[model samples]
Target chain A: MKRYTVTIGDITHVVDLQPLNDAEHYRVWVDGQVYDVALSEAPDHEPQVHPHPSTEAIPSASPAAARDRPADTATEPADLRAPMPGVILEVNVEPGAEVQRGDQVLVLEAMKMKNAIRSPRSGIVAEVLVRPGQSVNYDEPLLRYRQG
Target chain B: MNLLDTLLAGLLSLSWGQVVMMGIGGLLIYLAIAKEYEPVLLLPIGAGAILANLPLSPLVGDDGLLTILYNAGVGNEMFPLLIFVGIGAMTDFGPLLEQPHMLLMGAAGQFGIFGTLFLALLLGFDINEAASIGIIGAIDGPTSIYVSNQLAPHLLGPIAVVAYSYMSLVPIIQPPIMRALVSRRQRLIRMPYSQRPVSRRTRILFPIIVTAVVGLLVPMAIPLIGMLMLGNLMKEAGVVERLVGASSNEIANAVTLFLGLAIGATMRAEAFLRPQTLLILLLGIFAFGLDTAAGLVFARLLRWVVRGPLNPLIGAAGISAFPMAARVVQRVAQEEDFENFLLMHAMGANTAGQIASVVAGGVVLALFAAR
Candidate 1:
């Protein structure tokens, strides 16, 4: 459960969010009143790791929506992300591997077809976020590149 | 002395044709086991052929096990229709719903069926037999079996084999035709994924509406479409989870074995080793090529009029090989531009082909079955 403190026009409320079956659906409690919500589209670049809401969260925004800003803002270029939901069949690159744009980085099996995922840009790999056989949701980060 | 005479009698009666048929059966079994080419059906088919082709085989006479299964299922066309129920339950028409315009490609993908039908007639096959061969153009195994059993029972074995063999070869067969027809500039065209929110109510109503509309338009289509829609209705309703599970898994698997075996039994040496069998095999390739070309040309025509960023390669997916054809579209597109994701669009077309092929099967039967 992710807890947040909210102030809407000077009225404060305590919110508790609990994830349900999938990443999109959640059970949210606002001042002890509960409601189930489902997002129509999953957030494109939701950070795999979350910082606690008490420290860095804003005052009033729907916390989930807040995480879903423009995709280009904080995400560095060449940090490979899954374009669709699939299981990673193989990950060819490790940390610090030098790669060129359009080189095969990994193979992802989705819809029973093996999709060879290629590097979007030429860069040095900083870290690999996922390993072979890991099932990933659409747009989940696969690996990150070293920032210049 | 009696037991020895009985054992020697079996060897004495075996002919070259039976031996050749058994060898073919063994080859099919080998392909199914080693290569894993549509093994679920092929393995059963190979086994059935071997069982039926043995000299004075118990499985070949009127009261035989293989014949009983063939008469009960394939003879009446029950197995193929049952298989369609499972197919309907498994198919997700969401991508087609998201992009309704892709239905044109589905319709165009069936061009080879009619084209092949005419070719078969010129090659001296009777109208009904030609029509049966044409259904293989869609690469839809169940429909081919359904139509062939009804129209040309003699050709059922070869037609079913060709349909299944080509369906497994989808990845290998489709790429070259797709790459050839679509130039590099057209191949690189990117289609961004659009996830339209299809409502629960809409999903529930889709199957009912399709069954009614299609049933009325072509009454002959009622059986295939009705079963297909029934399965889809169960899936979308989500209330009949048990029924959906049974149809897609238990019932389908059981019937696939029966159907493949029955179709295989029809490949008795006398019926299968004909010169016309070779012609049917050649026409199978012709039909697939024409179907792919027709789809590509149709999509290119649509692009000119609609002025959308449509990739012609998605047209190849209109062949109704289900998700396989759709995946090939994605594979080929990524070959030219790795970022291009034509999967959703191709799936839309592929699913449309699923329905269109059924409708085409009905149309073909309506035109030629009685006459």
Candidate 2:
């Protein structure tokens, strides 16, 4: 397992990449939450790992993340949250679907307008948490991503 | 027997002109009921027209219900202003605030207003009357009524009707123009949604700043913009829930009914049935079309100038028909590319269009008032 810190915009994320069967799929830890990610292509550069500066360690288990995950270790995954309260109008992807950043994953109808919810990063969809016509609230788990 | 004869005298006194006006009222009622075109306003207007046209009807005579309502609100221009308060309460300016450049699209959309004004002039309409007729291009019902009521009171009925009827027909009227103006390649241009957080402080200050800026620049617009901003202030303040509720629902509904009835009451056959009315109707549609085209062309120019891709369809939302024009733009763009989502961006232009239309109305008033 190799840990790398990534920053986009103003938010910083610490991602731990664990190679599963091969270099193509990785078990990624964001903050303390685990996500299975499928790489669209092999990495050209090696991941840079650094020692924990402080004596305090990363939280052993993120309670919210652990509580939401099912007990199956084989299917440990990550989820996307709803941006706002709305009804799911369309789910554009299914399990095992590959998407790039900015690709629409689903559509949420809010304020009588349809808003496209996009993929935050390039990855494969592992599971869809909601179906069309289902009502969802702000920050509700929408779907999960996995590395192939 | 004497009392019955006296009561029946009203029915016996009906004129052919009044009967024709009643038939026109029926047509409006049918359009409202069957076609669902601005039914809230049209239905009340239709019923008022019939009531006023009745021989010796108490509803339209001195101190009668329609006359009283007209004098109390419509004639004095209170009803439309009250309706603006409701509109302001309901409107969300966040979209426009996030994308301030959409203000240009809003300004471009008013091109039709001026273009139609010139045409009305060529058609031999006096400057004041033509200006009132041109306001229909704004696609804003309350603004149209407010401007026409001030500049050309006699033209109010037809102008209000044309403005609203075309507004309801936006779905039908805009698509063809939108399709023809831009190539398919341009239509498929994708504009992804990007969320920009607007702070509460900014939201609270928006209405106040707009009121001062617009009020100073166009003093004629103060009454309309002032009431609209007042409602918006109450909503954003979050302390006046009851006021917001009443303004958006109860007061709006009440004023709409009064305004519609008063305007309809003015449509006695002798007043409404004229070649000028027909010309006004034609010119109204022309103004609407010109606005749509101008907005599209301006957006096309923007796409060339701006670095990012902007679906020109968003420009069509600049016609100030509120959510309807914006929705039509979204639907048209989606037809070409289902993955494309321009709703938030289109709404930005739409809200900008609303502001621009109000400003344009004030300008028209200013120009005519100058003389």
Candidate 3:
């Protein structure tokens, strides 16, 4: 049993969870609140969780295969980030746009504040990953940049 | 009396005090528009002051629109709570969760709130009134309202104005204090950007857990924390997109308009012209300065233990201006090292400051109530 102190919305709950045979499945008791948790790896660190249906079976990964997978897959380089989690108000720099450090590359509107995301270093823009109005995470690469 | 004679008489009877207050009000308006200092509050406040100081404006009268708004929102404390809902919907606590220890910085930054509270008491302001005045140091509007409404409702207008005014001045007041507290080498420290993927379960559970813990600790904070968490839970739940959108946008906008206008209208010359108001304004600035100093000092202490680059300037982000304080930290960090990017770290501390300010506000109320 792994004891996890989970704090949600200002209330801290000491949770004890019995790990299942499958890496993704666990029986969690959070301060007496029971939750059956299933973990899934999302693309690009997007926090998307679909509650598992009661009838769905937990998929098990063998110990040998589990050992081969590397940890820390979610870390992204600093140059590629959303600046703030918000709707992309505009994307000014396109693929192959030669940009210098501090060049305004995109406008993000979060909590009614218009923030300009600038290029981290002088580079040739490799790809623009998001479009206008696309909601992005804090670490998701907004664009790729190659050395100019 | 003839119409011309009555009009001239009314113009001539305008009090010198009212004229001076009007001019002071106009200066505030000018600062808001021209200098762009806290435009959201100052613009409306300046307008309200001007209108009220006019020879015979109906706006301050019993039947006036301003009076009606004041009664509907500010006097009753509904608008600030509603605004908290919007603030809740808009806030992203992921940064704070990623760096749980940053909460210490937030706590340290709130020294201004209590520090100023003590100072106000020293100046002979009564316990309850001093508590209300000291909350302006929190640099948070809703918390200021929540505390002042309970302790000293009469001082609400000055406290709110000072709270917001000093919040905007964070960029100006904080940087120098930060510099003074930390050396050039400290500011140049580059924090590595590390992104830890937070689970949706954790996100959804955060507001609930925080509300429960804080509410249990300070029952008076139940309303404020409950409403804040309610909004956060709605946003994190992902199923309540429509409710989140409405709360964050429409409800927030409506509340801000009402809250801003009503808060402004409370600055009647008679109420706001006193020396106490001036002292409140001065103490408000001092409180913010002290808060920034405390955060920087705490960050320097943490640097001794924590590995990796911990930019001390990011500690200044502990003030509760949300992203603005974070951006200012980012800007200052960029000035020090062209390659250094501290935005994410600054944001983490800034988000922690948001929660810390609420907790600090609650703690203050709890302390005063206990007394």
RMSD of each: 14.1, 10.8, 14.6
Q: Model 2 clash pairs?
A: A36-A146, A36-A147, A37-A146, A37-A147, A38-A147, A38-A148
Q: Write the per-residue lDDT of candidate 3 for residues B24-90, one digit (tens) a residue.
A: 7788789899989878767777777777777777887999988998888777677877878878888
State the TM-score, rounded to 2 decimals, of chain A in model 1: 0.49
* Candidate that would win on DockQ: 1
In candidate 1, which residue ranges exceed 4 Å CA deviation? A1-82, A85-99, A103-109, A124-147, B1-5
TM-scores of chain B, in order: 0.98, 0.97, 0.94
- lDDT for residue A66 in candidate 3, whole number 0-100: 26
TM-score per candidate, in order? 0.80, 0.78, 0.75
Worst 10 contiguous positions by lDDT, candidate 1 chain B: B188-197
Please write out the lDDT profile of model 1 over residues B52-147, one tens digit for every residue: 888888886999888899888888989999999999999889888888888888999999999999999999999999999999997799999989
lDDT, candidates in the order shown: 0.82, 0.82, 0.75
Number of the candidate with higher TM-score, 1 or 2: 1
Q: How do the candidates rank by DockQ, highest first?
A: 1, 2, 3
Ranking the candidates on lDDT from highest down gives: 1, 2, 3
Using TM-score, give the best candidate's number.
1
Interface RMSD of each: 17.0, 12.5, 15.7
